[model samples]
Target: METKFLVSLMFLQAIINGVNLLRPPDQHGSKCSKNGDLNSNVLLKSRDVALDELYKSFRLPFTGAQRSNNGGIWAHALCPPKEKMEECRECVKDTIDFLKKDCPKQKEGATWSIFPHFYCMVRYADHPNQGNLAEWAWVQFNAPPGPGNATAGELEKAWNNLANTIMEKATEVKNLERYGYGSVLYGPHPQNLYGTMHCAPIIYQM
Candidate 1:
């Protein structure tokens, strides 16, 4: 009985560790202007206003919007699909707090966080009406564990097929929220492969 209990505990610990590894890090990437042309104090004040507006309106059920202040301070916040109003609000709040603490005096900054069933993003810049289509920066995370006996070529083919499918579905007009999530099964044991894509609303207009 003692040995069985110990084995169970070990298995539980391994599962917990795997989950922790999958969770997004507290901070991904940040940038503070090195040229020092932008005024951090003014930007900070404007950021506060923008964030407040975003937090209030973004909490509305089944709605998404962008916020900006007159002083060239703009912000965009978003929560994953199917999130409830309260869950979205809380996620945005946490994201805002994390960015403010992690990236101080940054003319432009953005952060992404992944919770159990959802993810959120917070971004701000010292420019007005900047479209989301612009590709300022990007970040990549570790991939999940692969199939136990899949060949290198087989894995590549599976990944490519998954990526193409996601892109087609995510870009379709039916995806009003500009967010898509799906999974595919492949390989001998047929392991599940999951993928998600989200595009800011501004991109659709462009």
Candidate 2:
């Protein structure tokens, strides 16, 4: 029992570290910006539905979210609209769904943008002409290392580099565009293959 508990704790720690290292930073919650209008009142069901509908229409290969109105600032990370659209959509959908049950009528919230990396996702109740402005939110996570790996230290370092590269490239693109942005590694079991992440700055832009 002691051994199992220790292992479980270690596994959890590794997962957390992995998330921090691979995921890029993202600001969470609705901190109204200078250009944002705090009076928008995003709690209205109609506006929420509009935001969701607009978010789903992009047809990108991944999931995305926006604050609605003002071009719906859209942003994404590694992964392309042509490749992992479903994963992207589901990711954002899952967050909102979870919050609906979890927060209950809350207007502002944020989540780990990346599935299991340093990536961050965020949105707020700033809608209905209240204005939006969370352009460059920061969300940083760190991954230490795990045991039982052929090259634990080496893989961890590589994963860190992969996460950095993906986010660095992802944020530079103009809104509305998609990036097949992601990182991978060569191996057998965890041969390390396939990664996807995205962001949407346009929707939340005030």
Candidate 3:
């Protein structure tokens, strides 16, 4: 019963995170075509279809990228490491809905959202492999709310150390999903800090 209750809590948290993490399109810049170009229309249509397929059938705890026929559109979706299948589905659903609303006319777009249990990413573009993190056009996020019992300098130092560790561990593994997540305790209060890093499979190959 405890396990079931925990799962229920996670689901609720995921829904809340989906809503709270959404950001404005301008903060990430617009990649959508402005001139109503015919190719852009085709690409948009294809992207929509690809996103639908991915939402319908993607493996949990992994990253998947799909391309439309004739390669006019590409889309990618990723769930947080070790996410449950149902949670992953919900995350992808939320991500798709958010993208459509936030990037209504964009030819390319991407978003990263933090859910209570995990995080998810969704992106699409007119060209293939646009989901590659190294090639992503934008990265935006507010700083962590407040320093938790630690000085600003201590928090920065801890964050840098955690980030570097995650990166090193993520890259050391040559796999389809090269990502890592872990926690560390630091400072006089020994507050626990969590971090995660990921690169799309294509990015690893490149």
In terms of TM-score, the best-performing candidate is: 1
Highest lDDT among the candidates is held by which one? 1
Candidate 1 lDDT trough over 10 residues, lowest sum: 9-18
Model 2 segments more than 4 A misplaced: 1-47, 50-52, 55-80, 83-95, 111-122, 127-152, 172-180, 186-190
lDDT of 1 by residue, 1-206 (tens): 43223222111111111123355545333334342434666767877777767667753446433454536677777665566877777777787887787667767666666666556666776764444333332334444675456667766666556555655665689877765555666666666656555555662231
Q: lDDT of each prediction vs. the true structure? A: 0.56, 0.39, 0.54
Q: Give the C-alpha lDDT of model 1.
A: 0.56
Q: Model 3 segments beyond 4 Å from truth?
A: 1-39, 59-71, 131-149, 174-176, 203-206
| Candidate order (TM-score) | 1, 3, 2
RMSD to the hidden true structure, all candidates = 11.7, 11.5, 9.9
Each candidate structure's count of clashing pairs? 0, 42, 2
Error (Å) of candidate 2 at residue 134 is 10
TM-score list, all predictions: 0.70, 0.43, 0.67
lDDT of 2 at 72: 28
**lDDT tens digits, residue span 16-72, model 3:** 211244444333222343433325666667767877776677653444332232346
Error (Å) of candidate 1 at residue 61 is: 4.4
Model 3: how far residue 108 lies from native, Å: 1.6
How well does candidate 1 score on lDDT at residue 75? 78
